[model samples]
Target: MSLPVPPGPQYADKQFYINRGYHQIPKLRLSMDRIVKETVGLRPFRPSGPRIEAEQLGSKTIVHNYGHGGSGWSLSWGTGNMARNLVMATPERKIALLGCGTVGIATARLLQESGCEVTIYTKDVPPNVTSNLATGTWSPASRVCDPAVAKPEFRGVWEDATRYSFRRFQFLLGLNDIACWTDEYSVRNEVPTASEHSAGGEVYEIPGLIPERVRLGKKEHPFAADFVTRRSNLMFNIPSYLHYHLQDFLAFGGKVKIHEIKKLEDIDALPEKVVVNCMGLGAKPIFNDDELIPVSGQLSCLIPQSDIQYKLSTEGANFIARKDGIYLGSNGIVGNWDTTPSKEQTEKVVGILQEVMKNMRG
Candidate 1:
């Protein structure tokens, strides 16, 4: 008070850049201990959000909860709740749940909470199905709809889902080994080309969904790129998260059967009066949704680095290090269904990271 305080810009510079002791962020370096493994996953992306509606088929009432695209995990809790409210409208005490992916499991769990006996029918379960391939970021509106085709009325529904899903994710926090944690940094040298089906546009632009992002200056950022920024979001370790949910589902009297359905008639044959279809990508062929497409995605798994706690992405590529290992992801190929992990693509992404380091040193 004796002396006049420094101006705002000078104070910000002093606090953020000049004060090395207080402004301590990590210098980026990725260990080259050859990637332990690599894998690819296909995102069941629907441009018009997930199909959450009820349709009558023969004597059975069918409720749809599929085609969530990249937003499956983020939207699962809300959509499950939405579908369950529909299921509750009926008096059926027993329900048939199709598929065992994230959405399927979430639906079954929600139904269990509603006091319904659940039978999960599927060809595969977690860690083996397509759901395991997701990078598991908390982008709820991702690839959920196409703007041109999206109605003005959809904003209300989309906003509702985002709100509900966020509330559910908070309950999963503080599990062992970063099953749900935050990635705090993302440095971009260039802007990513937005696709028509890109999930980052209007849906996330809603009020009070995501927090504001910060643009980092030279002292605040450690990357080589001319531009740097930081934003925080959730990442669900799909393997562990599913394991936690599936185990509890069984404890709560849920039954799992390994059976594949080839046609709608098979579903009609179920004894349960109500069937909730959370088949995810499998619905593409069975339901013949022409608008749905396979989004080819690949992630390279490097050894876990405790020091690297943030995320990085440029162009169509994404790089992040989680508790398990480093994940290097390529851009989604909208119509591509190939799940083969490309050695060349992984190497290309690695080079991008290396270049970043080199530029930082220079």
Candidate 2:
């Protein structure tokens, strides 16, 4: 019922930031590093929060845990635990996990940790699933659910899942080259507000939706922008993180079978007693979930630059430097359903990222 207090603004000192020498990194451009790859991934988004309940069919229990939308990786660990507990309750020691993307793999491991034997049935494994192509920021609410239609109680579910996953990801911060890392963000003007800022959910009232934001003096910030807001954001380098999860799952006696189930009848054929549906977008056709939409997203990867440890967010796109490479992206199209990369969009993103990098160097 009370007004929210905003962070106090600090004046940007031109001389203070300029003298810091944070801008020492050489200019990075799209042309400088060859484009190693360009990838497109359709986020399995259900405007509603992920399907985390169960269905009973002829003595079989199928717990639906997919449809996380774009927040699959960000919310994986928490949802994994959610589905794991559901299966644990059924006294079913053998579990079948559908889909092997971030959500599926995470859920598979969680079931294993719960003393259940998990057999993953999927069309593709890590670094191959659509999850591998994500520009995976630990942004728990990025299209996780359409807050407009979400019930008031959904906020509680989101808060618990986000906070739980946040803690779980922290445990991976410095291990295995730590696929999870933070990067400095250079703002062109005022910091952009997240999309979920005004969805009328109680989660909006929670603090730390993003890491603490600090105003960078003109010289202190590494970028060329006159006004900059620096913040540390949790980023998951998809390729490396996927590998880590796969290896971890395999090390723990989990089994994976390369197969895709097209309909409900296919459930009867799996080796496990209970199933956790992490099929993501596949749930739409398989389970007839008309609410699920494939939000098409694309990212272009260039050569890696170890010196670059920052990200830049402009009006329509973002540029990030990851362990694998610098990523340039994207123009989102909802309901488009096309996964093919757009040459025009790709060129425009390159311009946006290259212009920012050039300005920073200047």
Best by TM-score: 2
TM-score of each: 0.88, 0.89
Off by over 4 Å in 2: 1-26, 194-205, 222-226
Give candidate 1's error at residue 5 in angstroms. 20
- Taking the tens digit of each residue's C-alpha lDDT, what string does model 1 give over 26-124? 445554455777787777877766789888888888889998877888889889999999999999979999999989998999999999999998989
| Worst window of 10 by summed lDDT in candidate 2 | 196-205
The collision pairs in model 1 are 45-69, 47-145, 49-144, 143-199
In candidate 2, how many Å is residue 344 off? 0.5
Tens-digit lDDT track for model 2 on 1-362?
11222243245433332445443444665662477888888888777788898888776899989988777888898888888778888978988888899888888888887788888888788777888888767667777877788788878888888888888888888876545566556455544454412111123434776666576554455576655655677888788888888888999998889987978889877767698999888888888898988888888888987766766667566777888888877555778788888877788877777777677644
| lDDT, each prediction | 0.75, 0.74
Instruction: Please give the lDDT score at residue 235 for candidate 2.
Output: 85
